[model samples]
Target: MTNFLVSSFSLSAAPRNSVSRIQQELTIAQKQVATGRFADVGEALGVTVGRTISMRAEMSNIEKLKGANTSIAQRFDTMQAVLETAAGSGENLMSSIISNGSTDEGIATNRRLALANIGQLVGVLNSSYGSRYLFGGGKTDTVPMKSDIVNDYATSQASGTVDTAWQTFVTANAGGDPSLVTADQMKSFLDNEFAALFVTGNTDPALNTWDLHWSNASSSQTQARIGESDLITTSASANDDGFRNMMKSYAMLANLSGESLSDEARQVLTSRSVETLSTGLSQVTDLRSEIGIGQERISRANDGLKAQTFILKVAIGKEEEVDSYEAAIRVTNLTNNLEASYALTARISRLSILNYL
Candidate 1:
């Protein structure tokens, strides 16, 4: 008789291997049901796994940009507040001059006001946000002005280039008594010598008062990256024309207030101060508008990033997330299959000559 023979070792090994395979499948299904995602993402996604990885990376980048944008927006807000306060101080100075007239008492009072405003301006420009000076441009760690503008003006008046220049102007014009100089002569000095000191591009040590004594701010502004390709200015410089001009106007009033000048000279000086202040106010307004534009651009960038994040999340979910209800059903089936496998393994283990007894 022809009979097929199978080894007892083969029978036992097949059943044991089947039980092991079923146990592994049950574990995977149980994990999927518990987590609502594929237990083996790379295995299930196969060659398409790269797409999910790319989407996840993009989402991470967008989140990082959004976080940075929050700080940029805050910096812009601080700058706006500072500029607004400076503008208000300018207005108050203008009002003080206009209402106080040109009498000796008025001049004294106005000098006090100008000095106070100078202090305020210096403090605002040196304003710091979390250890960084806001108006220092790219040199955020440095204080923009080493001292108050008044102190620098006083130093120049006492024993510096400004004092030397003033004496030279008086000598050349044969105008007796520096304090009693005529209006026309004072105008010429202001137009030629004093105004030159505050010009933004002037690098002459004898003329550029701002660079020599007043400011330590960098000309290069600070910037921030709010998006993948978007960059915007995030700081203002104390070395700008607006700030310099304002300081110059205040210096003229404060320095001349304590002097014994002719009525005509005082009138000319007051008129020039008013004109200079007006120009500085206009420039300060422009700076405020620039910060506003940056804020708007940051808002737009944040909106775009938020939208991109939403889209990427949807794509990632489709690739990695599993239906919980379906996974639960699979878990039940896998459990029953594992139990049947174990039963067959037990039956095979019992098949021996001793069972036949």
Candidate 2:
């Protein structure tokens, strides 16, 4: 009968509450670490490493494209300057030929000298940028003028006469003589033939007959086209009337060997030379303008690419970067909650049913 009055005592909820709070803090810390928001040491280390890797790749691509754009622009600029010089030289030579009558032996000498200048101009037409021939059309490895001397001319040897020889040269080598071939022909027999040769029927957009070419191997095919014209339909049987007219004019001038020719013949030949040169200049100018247009297009495309690359970088940054202020606040709050939880848990453990009794 000495049984103590049975009293049921329940433990206070502080211990459970403290455990729950501590668990919640741990969850928050885990989430922050995983999402890269809070500055948990492990999470911060991981985020920094990943972000550095992503940013390096993005930056590298941007830099590479930028360099390519610069190279393309510089090449176009150089081509423009060269064309300008060629045009000026042509004008000066034409003026000299027109003003000084061929009756003067000096006129023939001057003509030969001018022919040399034209040969120089042809050399310019065969200019290159990094291994690419600028004027060989799609054949970027071969020069546009193989020889500037008429005697060394390929077509002249084949045809035996200047008129027939050049026609043969153009037809056989250039696929067909261009309508504007008069000005492009060799000035002397010692000069090499002027013809555009390309890999047969190869119509790659970047490859034109005026461009240089090497082996058909993939490694050697990185050349670019520089000249403006590449006829889609080339025919030897069909007459290049424009080219024929130009050659006729050149032949007329070439035949005037001595000062004894009639005044009318001299006048006609001089007039023809002036006219042919003028026509040739027009063709060259037109081609140059076309090149300018191509250059503008490439520049615009490069600018657009740059803008897009910048936007991509911004997007990448948003996805990977952490806000330091937000991370710091979360870390502080988590630290405080964990400390409070621990204190509350200790206090609860001491308040058992026996302690209360």
Candidate 3:
């Protein structure tokens, strides 16, 4: 009597509604199994949403940091290759200078190599990567050293400022006979005439028309933060001590080509060239060491970031992802429940008042 008033519509609709709900749950479980994440991430994370979001943000930042480190690594590696060539050339120049540059036997050949070395140094200084000059300091678009300066520097041996100064000093002290010029006088000429060109930036209009290749670019070295609080220099400019010394050495080698090949001349040239080139070698070695340290630090930081990213990823997975094995089991149970509900609804719809009587 209590169920005598049950609506036939209700009897038919109840099982269908139940089956639909179970089918919906089954669909969500299937999605979770397929995608490895909860269908409703916000619902799954519940109170842990804050931690999951924070971890994901950190992971994103770590990826950006890795990208920056990769860029720095490429620059440093290219710089290392350049310095290797420059350092080798400087060392060889010292040895050649020590032997008086082979005493006119291979003078022409040595001159060619020396000139080529000048060009190579200028090329290296003007090296670039994607619009950024490796040695330009803050002037990324500018060539760090002018190749024309090499010619001017080499030609200075004959009639440039240093040559004029050399003539004046010799005329004043030794009646313009360079052979009669003392070692002291030669040293004085170098100190007074050429040292400024090496140690100080050339401001003479006739020397630098390009207005590039400043000698005090250390202050303009570019910096980047590979970490939250770590800032490091990423550029080595032409103003570096090694490049300055090497430039002077190369220039002196060129100048010597225009001088007398006598023992006295040789000794003076060798003395100056060897001393400066040796200093340059040492400086280049130190710079190499410094950069090596920087590269190692960057590498370690990069590894740390990757490890952190992995940890964050694992954390986020646990917080926002579904267990595929458990979801699969849930899918099976829900499918069976849906099938049973569908069959029960069909059977109930088939029932009639005569069968109950």
Could you give me the TM-score of model 3 versus the true structure? Answer: 0.82
Superposed Cα deviation of residue 199, candidate 2 (Å): 18
Best lDDT goes to which candidate?
A: 1
Q: In order, what lDDT does every prediction score?
A: 0.82, 0.50, 0.73
- Our tally of clashes for model 1 stands at 0
- Residue-wise C-alpha lDDT for candidate 1, range 75-182, written one tens digit per residue: 888888888898999999999899998987888988888877778888889998868889998999999886544354455432254456667777677554766688
Model 2 CA RMSD to the hidden true structure, in angstroms: 12.5
Worst 10 residues of 3 by lDDT: 209-218
- Rank candidates by lDDT, best first: 1, 3, 2
In model 3, pairs of residues that clash are none
Backbone clash pairs for candidate 1 read: none
lDDT of 2 by residue, 1-357 (tens): 586653232233655665677677767655665666443434545645566466657667667765765666676677778767767766776777766765576568545645455445545655677776554444556654434232332233212344454456557644553332333233332134322222223467354322232112121223332222211110010012222233333333443323243454455446656776677667667656766776776666566667767876676546555665675576677777777767865665565466667
| TM-score: the better of candidates 1 and 3 | 3
Candidate 3 stretches greater than 4 Å from native: 1-12, 99-102, 150-177, 201-218, 341-357
Model 1: residue 330 alpha-carbon error in angstroms: 3.3
